[model samples]
Target: MSEPTPLQTLFDTLPQSGSVEWIGIRPARGEAMKALNNVMISRGTGLEGDRFKGRETSKRQVTLIQKEHLYVIAACLHREAISPDVFRRNIVVSGLNLLALKGKTFRIGGVVLEYTGLCHPCSKMETTLGPGGYNATRGHGGITARVVEGGELALGDNVQACS
Candidate 1:
């Protein structure tokens, strides 16, 4: 293999580690999310009880968002605050720029996940966050990932991208 370019080196560098601040799962479609301190991640599936179940190669086995983005979205929508559960993502993390994990594999506790794509806002955001909801979530919708390895993950677990 050839030497990596400067941009590749920069992209591979991630010294900051994030912490899982919250976890949630929906038992069924359109149902409210149930928050949990911890949960089991299943390979080729997703958060054990999450309503979504995609194929083994599915890019959206799990969804994660930045905790800080929640506040930003709220501010964008002119709200004092917005609960993480309302976003319907599987995990809310803080301190790490999730975008850095794009096209990389990362670990949360013992679970390993591969970044798949961006988790764009769906029309549901309109009904959930009121007017301008979808627009407010644009670019702040976080990223989607597929499980590479299954294990238990809990609130406070460290999230780090693999080298």
Candidate 2:
């Protein structure tokens, strides 16, 4: 049998580590609750097109399968983390070592989300940040997570990770 994928491994290790803090969580443009509700009701699905394939063809269309995927939290550098395009994450966290969390799961505001895979840096992020953004953090800033247990999340809530 073939070995399990990285995501599989991650799932196997559950309630790994979790944390939460008060941070700004906003919906991206056209990602308002109403919009998401419309899509969910109209399409009966939250995911949209192919995230990687449509990158070249349709910039407007979300290329990733997990469209409307919420960024529970995002971290950015106040000054040192600057780039031409803003690496604006929905939730900004500090004191948590994301690298260490690799192959582990973390909970935010009581809502558990598995770190399925690395949020790879994309050209769009480079374009938005311009030259400075390309080399910033050596492409370390990418935010992607899968919902393990769905629930209402708000800013300023305590985030914890279960061992």
Candidate 3:
């Protein structure tokens, strides 16, 4: 309806492309995350067997974190390494900037997802990351998305702007 501002233009441009590095599924609330190379996504079900599958029907259907941010998050906690699992997000991607996808759709494998907003750290991080877990993940938590197209997504799958 109107011209987008420079910031909006940049946000709409997905300059970098990356692949799905890893996948995680939370089978139950407060349960340990399970790592997987592949996962099934349905319109209503977030992840086939994930605990949050049908509980949420909004942009929170799926979550993703940039793999590169893991190091930054770890540094904040003064840790040698931080497993992606600790974040509890559903997908780990590298190269592409998730923030840039807000309000836009991207395809991961055959599944399409629309970015909602930042997946800010929850109180769970306090215990998950240990002493400074919560604070370390403050800005590095990632983003949330609602499934747009249901399909299978797997490790090494290319994620790019919707064509």
Index of the highest-TM-score prediction: 1
Name the lDDT value of residue 15 in candidate 1. 95
Candidate with more favorable, higher TM-score: 1 or 2: 1
Q: Write the per-residue lDDT of candidate 2 for residues 76-148, one digit (tens) a residue.
A: 3234324212443334344454555545555655455555454555565456655544454343654445555
lDDT of 1: 0.94
Error of 1 at 156 (Å): 0.2
Q: Kindly give the stretch of ten consecutive residues in candidate 3 with the minimal lDDT sum.
A: 50-59
Question: Candidate 1 lDDT, tens digit per residue, 139-163?
Answer: 9999999999999999999999997
Q: Return the candidate ranking by TM-score, descending.
A: 1, 3, 2
Query: What's model 3's TM-score?
Result: 0.92
Q: Give candidate 3's error at residue 120 in angstroms.
A: 1.3
lDDT of 3 by residue, 120-163 (tens): 99888887778888888888889988888899999999988884
Model 2 scores what on Cα lDDT? 0.38
**By the lDDT metric, which is better: model 1 or model 2?**
1
